[model samples]
Target: MQVKTFSGASSQEVLAQIKAELGADAVILSNRTYRKNGELCHEIMAGVERPAQQGGAGMPVSAGAAPAPSSGAGWSEWHKDWMRVKEQLFMLMKPAIRMERLTPRQRVALEYLQREGVSDGVSIALYNMLAARPGASVLESLAGIVPIRSWGAAAWPQRVHLFAGPYGNGKTTAALRCALRLRKEKPEMQIAFINTDCLRGNGRLTLRHWAELSDFGYLEAADAESMRKALALTAEADAVFIDTPGMTPERNLAQWQHEMGIDEQPHATHLVMCPFYDGVQMQALLHRYAADGDTSLVWTKLDEAVCYGALVNVAHEARLPISAISYGPELKQSLSPATEPMIWRLIFKRQLPIQSGE
Candidate 1:
């Protein structure tokens, strides 16, 4: 793991520097504006965590350690403070439907969801659930309405994991993160990479670079025949990641499968997305990318998203399960298996989950 602080003129410049220095797997700890040399500049703290280069026991290792996860007490206090601010903000506005006996906090919380891009009906459902169960309100609201499916290493039923999503949605980065995490946990296990995204030259180079660094086999395939040969050749590996180019449902799913020579055995597709996408865009993407029940949702760019309700709302409405989430440009601690509390925090809290922990 390596950590560094970079100063630049703007947010984009700092992020580019982080990505360039730490690669896509780096995680951002903090970003702020400060005066450097009597000039206004932005500072960013970023880090990278990789599997131990010369280790056998699979010990967790990182170059830059981030702040510990917020304790339960601290999280509660932050929620309470946000509630107060929200109540004050809404006090100036009139309620569309006045319901007696509703607490100000409850009303404000409802508005918060609306602002987070939830539909009116879905927001009302969440409000009613929270109102009925004041204790552990967020947990109760999500448990009954949405599913947080687990995709930890133990959940991999197939040897071939397929990553597919819209271009620029972070599929390549997600693949690297997942691959490294798996290797870290199971050092003795055999791993390999099979890239089907042949059209993207830069993406192919990035995957190959990681392969060279990690000392794993990397292969590329363009069509069904080549993919079939790649799989047959890597049959000895325990797990293989198959990365594809941007796929949309508007295209022929069957034809695409045929072109890739995809088989039912030992294969599963995961749709990767950024949580900042609005409801309409998400629905369109899901309709095209995740039409099958087997496809699970993996969110990226959690730090960039101002709110996460729309992502959850789309999943709930479509009956899709959220399998994982990635928070920043840094690959270290960028992705994690999804959980109920995680969804709750992403919806209500401004801070991103800062670590990859239990």
Candidate 2:
């Protein structure tokens, strides 16, 4: 990998420079903002895979060309070695899971968490915590890993919020519900909606209808230039909620955001998801939507899920705080700001956030 650092007056400027030098396949490693010479500036570190050499001539291979015959075998061997190491580690840890050391209640709770789909790694961590601190409860241990950051003006002070997720994950509805909640809490706040999921007629219409009915500003942007224009027009609004399209197999969130100019601004991106997806699918979605900016998780369709194990797994894996959750079929009154009590109820008690009036 070829890594480099870039700094400029704005994130957009630095991002443009990185792309110009490293092309579209660059991966952002880190980014920060600081005052340089009495002026605010953004710095970004990015890396890209170096092109493979061909024919011993040091010539770079084209992206679409076939790789050397040995490349597939090399990758297969590497994967096998990795799996063996993981298996060995798990084998070593299995002997330490002494269920008899815990009280009957703790044992049952730990067993239940395992049945609910919590991974072995997290269960082991919880076991260690309980064994070290006999006074701590299972809920306390879980809370340390699964954090909650309630969604509102106080928790999220950013003016622009972007909602992105897989197809049929209810990103549009979540965005609308957030806007409604904001309007109810702060009636004087000027809110706007920016739609980038133009490929779906139903979602686009729904966003436009709600924005018009609520008397909030609304615009549609299909690409970077239009998005720039839309942002410029909504610059006066107190808050802007952007609804993004679901990522296709050919597209990536980071690259798409960079191309649309969304990464250039200071904003928050919420990854909307559902709890019904299996662990493998959830991991794939998380990997696909990973971003280097302020991002949080928004779970939807809690009312339809049979097991909430994916929730714990995702929180432990992504380390992103839960921002909000949605249940039921209604757009209004179905979404709630995530809190520890609410999350624990859903995971341990099979209770939805809206059920407890959270």
Candidate 3:
């Protein structure tokens, strides 16, 4: 038995990271929630034990396996009680193990069940309610509850590429990288980079560097008319990428749409994702971003993460075709179009390798 440890803000995050490193068939041994470094964290300890070739019991015995000293007559009854509890937990978690589709929150609930020795009936009742409601968190559903999935370029439409996400998700940097990539790929093609993030100094500096290096057109839009006029001019160019500030769920998305003039010829919306995020939170975050139609996913910092479970959930639920994925901070050349087989290898194990152009 090989044991591994992981820590994350949520169980979904931890599991996603683990799956990315260990693969889907890895067995979980134990999981628990604990406070760490001033934040609530989930600590999961898992084991990756190979299964037996033939159909046989594969449970690993404890190293110091020995009968415990107990009341002489009561040992048998105690053992039966423990076995019953274990059976209940196994039953409760079996559904999740077999489920082909599970939300991040649902995934967390299943983990909790596996850890807490919950009954099968309890797990079912909770899961069913969540299935019916469809909006509650996974934890909420399991407590009887619980809650809670980018970008592509091809023949740009002289239209601006809008980058919007929560703060620190790396929007401005990506915009610059994309610009450089476009310049390298088609030097003759006219390209422009627009920045709407006037409030951030980093945004301005990044755009400035792009302007100097690529000799590509750069525009700034402080007002709707300016943005509209800029769009009108850029519409003549081969492609225009618009970089917008990271907005929150609290702001009126409609107002932002109106201000950014997104209502007119909507540009490709790319949802930038950090690999460090847990599965459940990632789904919730994607949902918020996807509220606006025509949104695709751009997975960022793959070089920094081990698990890709969030990627799996995003692919499954949103049914959003992943256009490109980025591994690092290099210019747009660091990003590549995500293919089905690449995604498969990232998720399920035992994937039969298929030849490209097949």
C-alpha TM-score for every candidate: 0.66, 0.76, 0.54
Error of 3 at 275 (Å): 2.0
Over 1-358, each residue of candidate 2 has an lDDT whose tens digit, in order, gives: 7889999986657766876787544556777779978999878787766647523322232221112222223443333333333343344356658988887888898999999988766777778888888767889888887889999999999999999999899889899998888888899999999999998898899889989998889999999999999999999999999998888545668878999999889999999999878655665577668777788999999899888888887888787999998888887899898889888889999998667766
Candidate 1, residues 1-358, lDDT tens digits: the string is 5779988986667766765665544556666788878988978786665545522222232211112112223433333333332232223122333534356666667677778777644655565566566543555666766777766568766788888888998999898888887888788778889988888889999999988788778999988778888989999998898888886544533346656767544577777888766644664565456433366778888777767776657666566788888877777667787787777777777555674244
TM-score of decoy 1: 0.66
Identify the superior model by TM-score, candidate 1 or candidate 2: 2
List model 3 lDDT by residue over 102-121, tens digit each: 56766665555534333343
* Residue 55 Cα positional deviation in candidate 1, in Å, after optimal superposition: 60
TM-score attained by model 3: 0.54
Worst 10 residues of 2 by lDDT: 62-71
The residue-level lDDT of candidate 3 at 70 comes to 22
The candidate that achieves the highest TM-score relative to the unseen native structure: 2
Point out where model 2 deviates above 4 Å. Answer: 1-88
Among all candidates shown, the one with the greatest lDDT: 2
Q: What's each prediction's clash count?
A: 8, 0, 21
